[model samples]
Target: MNLALWIAAGLLAAVALAGGITKTFVPKEKLARANGGGWTATASVGFVKTLGVLEILAAVGLILPAVLGIAPALVPVTAVCWVLLMIGAMITHLRHNEAKFIVLNLFYLALAAFVAWGRLGPEPF
Candidate 1:
């Protein structure tokens, strides 16, 4: 369990950092291709940027508490929140005909769910 959590935390941190960096640097036009719906809505740039910020924060929350053994509960909370957000992202992709991103969203969502379950779900032999 410890190993799983640590690996997941690393993945989470790397993913968040990479995404945050991308959002912070990439031009909006380029983002459109990687994003859902080809970034049709003008608000998408802001939306994704904000989401990136949130993800980075959540990733930090997941690692800081547990890694430092300060407040471990926060890790599960962050995972839960990330799962919810990914669900919303999946919906957004479907609504916008951005099928490409849906798979990646689902992958992230599943990974988040795994983290949540590993942290909070019942033990299974």
Candidate 2:
């Protein structure tokens, strides 16, 4: 991988890994409070756990294929999936009027787009 691809991949890996860890282990009460704090939501733990799992899966799909040189196709697929995931996050936060998390979602969307675009063409140095 060239500098651009490597950087994009690294960013995706970092974000997904961090978010996954956060969702997987963050305390339920704390997470619920941080999750916009309303609506008597009992299933937040489930959402967080599910998000963690998907993030981990996306992380693997993002790089393992390119590294192994077996199914490079997975790289772009993973990038697109992450972009969609972030878009969903953006919409969700917007609906909830959570400005803070919405901003974070935007960052993820941009980064995911960068990864998707960067991975498409030749590896740039």
Candidate 3:
């Protein structure tokens, strides 16, 4: 169970990092064109960039505290934050009628929730 939690956290960290980097660096127009979606269009540049920064911070929080054996409790806390982020993402995607996207977001949400539960309960490290 501990190993499973680590694997899930690692996967989430990788995804969040990639998403953060893309959202932070890519031009808004380019992203819209690349994805051809209303999700980004519905949000302001500042808002998207802010989300990106938060995601990056969350990604770091998911790994660093636990790995370094310092303030390990932060792992579950960070997972909770990821859950909130995914919930918001799902809501936004649903508003855009992007059911397919919501499916992926839900998967991410579930993984984050699992990590939160595992780290807080059985897999404290």
Candidate 4:
């Protein structure tokens, strides 16, 4: 269970880091164009960037606190945050009728929820 939680957290961190970097640095218009006017098309640039920063912070919180043995409780908290973020992503994708993105969001949400459940229940670091 511990190994599973670590793997899930690591994968989630990698995905969040990549997404954060892209959303933080890429222009919103370009992102929208690339996605064929998906949710990014309707979202404000500031909102998008803020979400990216939050993702980056969540990724860090998922790993660093547990690894450093400092406030390890934050790992589960971050996982919970990721779950919420993915829920929001799913809602936004659904609003845009983007079925594919919603699937991906669901996948991420599952991983985040698994991490949260494990850390908070049987696999505390």
Candidate 5:
């Protein structure tokens, strides 16, 4: 279970980190174009960048605390945050009628939830 949690956390962190880097650095117009003028089309650049920064922070929070043995409780907290983020993403995608993105968001949500449950219940660190 410990290994499973670590793997899930690592995978989620990698995805969040990659997404954060892209959303943080990529221009809104290009991001919209890349997504077929989807959510980014309606969102402001500042809002999009803010989400990116949040994702980056969540990614770091997922790993660093546990690895450093400092405030390891933050691992579950970060997972909870990721779960919330995915819920928001699902809502946004639903509003836009983007079923595909919602499915992807569900996948991420499930992974985050697993990590949260594992860390909070069975695996302390």
Candidate 6:
């Protein structure tokens, strides 16, 4: 169970890190184009960058505390943060009529929720 949780956390971290880097460094026009336009069209660059920063922080929160065995309890807290972010993502996607992205958002939501539950339960780091 510990191994599984670590793997799940690692995967989530990697995805969040990648997302953060893209949103922070990539040009808005390119990101908008890549995301099918409708989404970023309604969002400001600052807002996107803010989300990116949150993602990067959450990614780090998920790993560092647990790995260092310092405040390992933060792992579940980070997972909860990811869950909230995914909920917001789902709402935003739905509002923009982006059904495709919502599915992925839901998947991420579930994964985050699982990590939250797992860490808070038997597999806590």
The TM-scores of all predictions, comma-separated, are: 0.80, 0.81, 0.97, 0.97, 0.98, 0.95
Off by over 4 Å in 5: none
Candidate 4 residue-wise lDDT, 4-116, digit = tens: 89999999999999999889999999999999999999999999999999989988999999999999999999999999999999999899999999999999999999999
The lDDT of each candidate is 0.76, 0.77, 0.91, 0.94, 0.94, 0.89
Candidate 2 Cα RMSD (Å): 2.9
List the lowest-lDDT window of 10 residues for candidate 1. Answer: 34-43
Predict model 6's lDDT versus the native. Answer: 0.89
Residue 103 in model 3: lDDT = 95
lDDT of 2 by residue, 1-125 (tens): 56667777877888898878777887767766775573114556777688888998888887788888878878877889999998888777776677888888788788777877777766422
Candidate 1 deviant stretches above 4 angstroms: 33-37, 122-125
Cα lDDT of model 5 by residue, 28-102, tens digit: 999999999899999999999999999999899999999999999999999999999999999999999899999
- How close to the true structure is residue 80 of candidate 2, measured as C-alpha lDDT? 90
List runs of model 4 lying over 4 Å from the truth: none
- In candidate 6, what are the lDDT values of residues 37-105, reduced to their tens digit? 877867899998999899999899989999899999999999999999999999999999999989998
Candidate 2 has a TM-score of 0.81
Report the lDDT tens digits of candidate 1 across residue range 64-124: 8876778888888888888898898788778777787899888888888888888886521
Best by lDDT: 5
TM-score of 6: 0.95
Candidate order by TM-score, highest to lowest? 5, 4, 3, 6, 2, 1
State, as a TM-score between 0 and 1, how close model 3 is to the true structure: 0.97
Collision pairs in model 2: none
**Off by more than 4 A, model 6:** none
Q: Number of clashes in every candidate structure?
A: 0, 0, 0, 0, 0, 0
